[model samples]
Target chain A: MNYRIWEGKSGDSLNSENQKCTSRCGMTSSRPGMARRSFLRGTAAGIGGMAAMAAALSPLRELEAGAFNSVEEMLQKHYKEMTPDDMERALARIRRQVEQRYHVRPEIRDIKPVEGVEFAYALNLSRCIGCRKCVHACVAENNQSREPEIQYIRVLEMPRGTLNIEQGNHHYDRPTVPDDKHFYLPVQCHQCANPPCVKVCPVEATWKEPDGIVVVDYDWCIGCRYCEAACPYWARRFNFATPKIPKGALNPNMAYLSNRPRPRGVMEKCHFCLHRTRQGLMPACEEVCPTGARKFGNVLDPRSPVSEILRTKRVFVLKEDAGTLPRFFYYFDERYPRNTGGEAPTWTGPEEFPHG
Target chain B: MGMILAGLSAIMPNLDSSRQNEFDGAQPGLEELAHPHAEPVDPHIPGGALWAMVGFAALAFYFVSQPALPEMPLAATPVVQASEIAPGKRRDPIKEPPRIRVGAFTYGCNECHSLFLSAPERQGPLAQHTHIKLDHGLNARCFNCHDRFDREKLVLRDGSLIGYDQVPTLCSQCHGTTFRDWERGMHGKDLGSWDLSSPRHVRLECHECHDPHAPAYPPIVPLPAPNTMRMGTPVHLAHEHKPEAGNPLAPWWMHVAGGDGAAHGPGDAHEQTTHHTDGKTESAPSTHKEGGGQ
Candidate 1:
């Protein structure tokens, strides 16, 4: 394609147009009026030139949505860095977007953690039938994206004789659970005291609250996905596409640091249903469990259900050796927890769990 | 002197004015001086003032004659407590069997036991309640829970009778650990406010989940499973396969992709995951005895 016809030495002639362009650009041009005429002619093309430009840049925009929302999103201040007025504007912006897209006026509030209340969840593994009721309850209560099927809870089925999480199957399904030889262990975000996800976020989008719940500011998340990679439990989920939930299925009850409709290209995980929990109500997952396996309450209160579970039952945390200091605990009975009574029910310890 | 003068002046006016008005309007007589004989005024109260007095009297009479409010059933008792409640406010009753029925009918135990003498032993193989099947864990004996003397009440290890409302007491006789857990709001379902002080909170009794006759949870269906996040595609159940020996931590999608993991869900394979075809199969009593029943 190549002849150097438009090179510095190959100018054809100086024109009046070159003089005008040279004045505007402040470049010493021989044919200054030529450039100025072209600039006006380009303006004359109007949106047609824009169409041509868009077509030319279409390949790059396709790679990443470098369109309208990106520029403002990239300039957004970190959630923690934003002032109260900034937060109000951001929240209002989010509320408008949610209302426009979902046709629901979502109350996107920044719900504060209650003073003197630190929430903890306890699941009775012996009572848990691995029903997956808690899992779906979370999906409905939290505005989870239904298309990619983001669920907060994953009930793993372990072989009879193992506590090895690596050997557990998260996709366990059955008519009735407590599969004679198999037991279930459901995993979600642990809301750790020392969370790697919070530590790894380049932007301070996620952090641990005073109530011990780890939360993420949806607006501040830059979708770097470092948190997802850092978490050992696979707790964080990334939104690959703009999350498409039907307006009908949207849970209008939303909170800023927890389960509001997240923008595309952000990371989200469970926040222990902070919206409901902070309001003196049980979490949706705990309320829906049929076998009464899930228990949640304020840890500070001596009489709370979680306190009782922690005090009396033999409780263990997943990946205890990892030292995440999880607030979620799993307690099991001594094999025959239901029958610790009259007839001397025979059973052994954890070691006797039938190995696959 | 001033007082005497004032009294004499009042007397003089009556004497002088009465005589004057007598000649002005009255027929010329000293007897008519005080009465002014021309004007015949009626000695009655004015109509407007009388009507005002009547209205006031009627209003007072209506208020005085109004009926009193009826008495309430009980006067001002605190609603916060009962001798035996789960731990919170008394709410809608728990989901459980409504108390023991007699024979094949829905009659209460006291209806029949009130007449018959309490039996020391089982009545006979021909007993009416023989239709009943008890397959709870190990503590399966009838006398272990039910009172020998009072058929209507539950018996603790002690010879005392426990009312239906005190079922947790009857249950706590041997299951002390679970009772403690339940008291602290752990073991049982506390369908109430998390703020314990809030009203309408209730901890369901043990019988809500376990049938008294069959305490073991019956095999039932589960809620739907999570599919690919954001896509509404229902995950396909795995055709019969074995679970992979390792790689359990590899995320649910990895297990599903491997095809070996979906084998655990027996319901999904047969008769859509929603329906339970095998739930009715345990009607026969033989298959009930096991847990070795954990």
Candidate 2:
């Protein structure tokens, strides 16, 4: 039985049979020879596997070393796990990277959420002129890729007489906006309370902060694009190729979870300008809106603009049927479209057009 | 001197003939100019030489008489203050109140209006304030907003005068709903900070965004449309769906029939029913109906 076992293990039946009597049960002299033969065979298989692995990774050699992440970045912890010291180190590394690439030493910080502050956005549908200024302002603020343009906002020109978004045209090219026959509706990340994008993330690379901003950990994301697919608003943008931005156009103010220059194959979206908003500044889109259509503020305080809007205005969210419960809302003012020949009352004199 | 004189003399005959041809009105024939021998030679300190000397003298006199270029001043490098360069600090977008330019000087509305007496009745088409197009949808009278006696102040419904900064209060008399929204920072633009506790919070005045005389917003040229569609096609060209066809994403009722040259879908009957219902409701929010008198 011992002799048969030794022969089976060695796969050398004829030789094993010749030495079986000595090697198997009692003799120790034949043991060294059998061990040497098995060790040589194992080494050959191990070498073959290593060669295959090296060949498989050969394409990575073409990647530019400077553009790729350093050893420190590759091993950096997730945003939630990083301590203050780790964050400082990460920010320093980011600053160095940005300075080296964009020639601007960005004031990058890992801005923490303020206590008791929850940000929400409200847009006036009646006032939005379909100008697309908000969209461009967002791109400039977020340091989005220019050529392959990753804009957070998509303004749709919906024909009058319907609230249906499907009936909206995203690519409306008109001489002027707010066409007599059409109204504009701009769509962006709703920052949902029950964000499906966060739920579907396999690695938990994205999460909602205490302040209600859904942010992505660009370093931790594996670029699987599950979150992009799960998002109903199509807000998440996947960097298909290396993002290109002019050095002069890059916004020097950056944050780890918000508008930092993202590497290729990472997911990014509107963090509601968390870098600026956390510092109590208005979002870029809201600031650039010419018609005063965009409004953003803390929803926690009763006196906050968003809170007032919610309390007073008949606000509605896009894709409400999806049960997203978005922080962003859309509302309308009570007024006729200007210059529409609506039967405005006639004014005889100052008596009729009273001081009021 | 001799060589110079000889060169000037050689060029003189042609110049004289050309000048005479231009100014004297008796033009020389091309054949006479081409064949110099066809014309008699007259050389009395030729008219061309005199003119050339005059031109040279004028050129020399102009250069000598001109003032020397002032020493180029060093580029005025702006001295940036520390507070100006401080991080997170932004300059205010509106630095000063609106002023009326009268002749060479800019003056506040009260400066000139204070000198004149208040008109008893609504005056005819204004001669001075002609630029103020009163097209604010029936709220057209000047005294409707301006105080009759106090030119600097805005008049309210209660016949009380308020300062220029209080335009919102004056606007609120008629635009109650909009003013209510503006009070909460919902209607007009709010800058600086969303946090109420922050010292930087600023709500813009009504007159900042809208013209007082013509409250209705004017049409402005929109920014260029997005050109980042898939397959590298521009947005406008990529989706060239005809406007008459209505939006492709539109519901069957919203879509115009006979677009794309195809027969109507099975929802044709349902489309007609919904279309009639939709016509009555319209797309406007219910608030427009409730708050109608704006």
Candidate 3:
């Protein structure tokens, strides 16, 4: 059977499809009978040539070593896709890497959410002192990139009377928090019931877990940056380069889906320390908080502190209009007695952020 | 078809084995599924999701029908973790109560107070404890805290003896609200499991934060400032200067002396009482703008 392949080019007349080929070769056809076999051969050769070139540079990849890790990482499956055997192999690979690089035995696991556990977190805006203890604790806990500085929690010090998060300062270096003329509001991943980040993820790399933690698989993330752009609270962070962490400082405790050492060009966000939380331990921030401002517990359990807080305290979420349905709540105590100057604080309601 | 179905059934012999090899805590029920898909599942109903739903519904019904009130735990256990440096490396000035140490010897109140150390001698001043300044809002007499009879225990107003561990009880006599809040894990630092079933949380003692004698927390060095990548620094913006609106082509030197930032009220460096704003006496805005922020 003789078939002609149409080369769609600019200014070609519609009747050009019937025009006979003027080539000297034995090919006398309208467009050209680009034999399917030849086309297939060309594709195979191109792919093979590329692979051969890549293989020729294998020595360089071996020399770098991390190149191999990157390739292996790129080939790895998402957490949901991995079978038990695959997970075992993945865990072994991770353990080997930690032992080889950090010279420390890490207990990295793919921890699961607990039964009858739906985690809820509430931060007492009145109690947080903007100490950054929770921030550092998170960095240390989650193996966040240190150099370019990826901090999940941003403790913004708002002037005495302002609900403007834009005006909130995360880098306020102070001796103590709850400064007389300022209030601190530390914001991190709200882990919304309907997360825009999860929705916008092109690779399906990130998803909300059973325990209300939104987790990202660094391996599966193509780093298209759609999730980062979609996040309302600026919760997600991307590794622009290979995340540099001092081997000694690398947290031995890690989770494959959350805090494991990520390859360059992957997105990571706070997952509420799934490794610890699954084992009935508190998240790093809650443990290190000097003021008992952060309250986290199973929302399903009515007796849990977080449930009590939600019921008793006048709770509010950031950007309720966005309709992300954030699980994280920010609440203020009834008594904010400390007021500066002659003007009173613009605290209209307990649910309202400090509005000027 | 029968053989294939039987083979599939045969693969599930371990159903009664309580398989614990699931990754993290993910349900083992996923493996039993005839089909596996990579797309996100309804996490609300993971593996064995049907059974879980049934169990939850049953529990809900039981709780709704029961007249006996649900019992709340005394306190949720906070999973204790090392703060600052590791447990071994932390100086931890006061774990609970302040203690006096000289050379290799640690001293109790009895070490000094027994020798002619009656209540009358406190006003006369002593050779030791001179460095101690009782500045905790008026209740500052030596015997107000220290037991007059027993050298080791604290003396409550009603003459009850309280140890260092029970210092909050003694302090609660005056600072009732804070004490109440502290007990409920609101005022002070606490570590542990947020689970209702976890053991009692370890609450930080009153003296862990406050100085017993001074009782006022002195200003300490701040943590390292965050370089929030794209977000930049979190400096309180005095005014948002849109380059197009303001003098975009302002001389580079003007920026050093403060940009046409909000068109200043006469760049008079001397008259700006604006900051002394930062407790310093010298006329600022004349020299340091960035340095003062740190």
Candidate 4:
């Protein structure tokens, strides 16, 4: 049997009629312990009957049972090896799952990845208060794994006294904000001009898009986690476990720039809520900011608020001292008198964000 | 006969004086001696009574004028430090001037015309009714609002002048931004709506909605109703292509566009760009992560 034919035919080989049988066989191979018993529910008269009987009588059942030890290994394939057929199959499988998972059948399409559009991002950090609204928003926008261990927006709480964000951490479980000892400075993917993650990838699995967003081709990623390690901001996340977002919480509005619901064993990072931004709307984070701190706009447009702030404010990029040319920049209100002098500055630094 | 008459009158006067002296001797110093030093001819009055009457009149005048004296000293003292009195100083006593406190018989001239400690809410009574209301009625007299008393300046014999134009400064004591906004023409009712040529504009008093003392407004809340549906058509039907096999009736664009072809499957790809299948002809996809999300 030609393995290349199987690989080539992966996407489109199965029709709606054979989809269940093919998926069952596909799932059986990845599981070693499961009995390779393929359930053939169809009429025996079809497919010339003899081959069907041979397929039924032979050890194909046992072979099918052992097909999938892990669902991700069964579902995901390298993008380079993928053909029109492989993509069609993936689309079909996705549709089947969508119908099974949600009683509603959603039409699935094989999105041809776009080319040449260079993505860039600019964050008005001066406007960011550590609301953690972005964190929940990201989770909902991206159907990210809801496991407590996984978080897409790693909001780093940097206290007032410390300028060093590395020592600041998000793992402290006590509550949202620690106390008076700290003011929160949430740090996420800076989407650096020169990304260390891109350089470290063994496979060309991830590449920086024209718009300045670094996206991973999930099919190409081997889950080696080299990108996660190389990232200075610790922005990359490796999916070691299966993904599950409550059906009720799923954000139906999704876009490829923001990445669709990803299965396990692929690394994920902040895609800047691509689905909404690409559609000409503000990110959920910007929408939810009560203080109007997180401003987003086209940096190219001088009229845009983001560009205006850059032009007017004495803004400094994080670790600018390192020359990363981080798109995220923070500005301090120089006129703001420190509470140390007279009394505390009236702003208790957002009463809710008690964490450092 | 003549010698006998004279001797009888003289003897009679001598006999009366001797009797008076014998009566005074009984009480010694307590009794007045009938001598030439105490001689008074008129039984009714003395001519020196006019001088005594003048002295008594002067004493009575002083007692009557005591009420009119100013309680404070005639000279103005320094407010910060009384001893270091500055020249041209206004002797403004910090004390609660009458009618300035909870109650006063007559409204103080200064109340509504100037800024005062009697919070802005207290100013309303003196403004409309010429009388302080019952809640503010008992203690909050007229001077509570009209706090600029002209008594010291002696500007008004009756002290009825309410200093106009000084109203803004008084109103700005608390409704500062609103006053500033109104002054800058950013807010307030526009009187120059018809005549744009003139910059002249008038703003209503700050007391219109808010009492200056507790000057605040409800927090910002966007109109809670969901945004009106996009003003245009709800669904436009467009089918891009004719089918090859599956359902002859079902267009390829419907399958390609992913269900709901009525919503996305525009009939002509060239005319409508909503669901273009060709990536080349389709609008370029954005590279940047949609939101600057981390």
Q: What digit string (tens of lDDT, one per residue) describes model 4 on residues A1-356?
A: 11111232344442331354344533222211211111010111122233323433443333332233346446666655677787677656655554555444543443332343323333433334454555555555566665423455555444456566543434222222223344446666777788888889998887766556667776567798999877766677777555655656455554433545665578888865655554455555544433334555456555444565576667776766555566666655433212222332233233232111
lDDT of 2 at B86: 25
Model 3, position A69: C-alpha lDDT score: 60
List ranges where model 4 is wrong by over 4 Å: A1-93, A101-127, A167-181, A321-323, A337-356, B1-294
State each model's CA lDDT, in order.
0.61, 0.67, 0.62, 0.43
Best by the lDDT measure: 2
Off by over 4 Å in 3: A1-65, A68-76, A97-105, A173-178, A337-356, B1-128, B195-201, B233-294
TM-score of each: 0.63, 0.66, 0.63, 0.42
State the displacement of the C-alpha of residue A220, model 4, in Å, after optimal TM-score superposition: 2.0
Where's the lowest-lDDT run of ten residues in candidate 3 chain A? Answer: A20-29
Of the two candidates 1 and 2, the one with more favorable TM-score, higher being better, is 2
TM-score of 2: 0.66
lDDT tens string, model 3, A232-301?
A: 8888888865676765778888888878887767898889888888888888888877656788878898
lDDT of 3: 0.62
Per-model DockQ against the true two-chain complex: 0.08, 0.11, 0.10, 0.00
Interface RMSD of each: 39.1, 37.2, 24.2, 59.6
- Candidate 2: DockQ? 0.11
- Please state the CAPRI-style docking class of candidate 2: incorrect
A1-356: candidate 1 lDDT, tens digit per residue:
11112334324332333344335632222221222222222232333333334444444533433324644555668776778887787778778777767789988787888999998989888888787767776777787876655777777666656776654555444665556666778888888888988888887889999999998887777899999888777778888656666557688888888788877778899988899888877777777777777888888988888887798888988777777898989988765444322453422333221210
True contacts kept of each: 0.22, 0.31, 0.23, 0.00
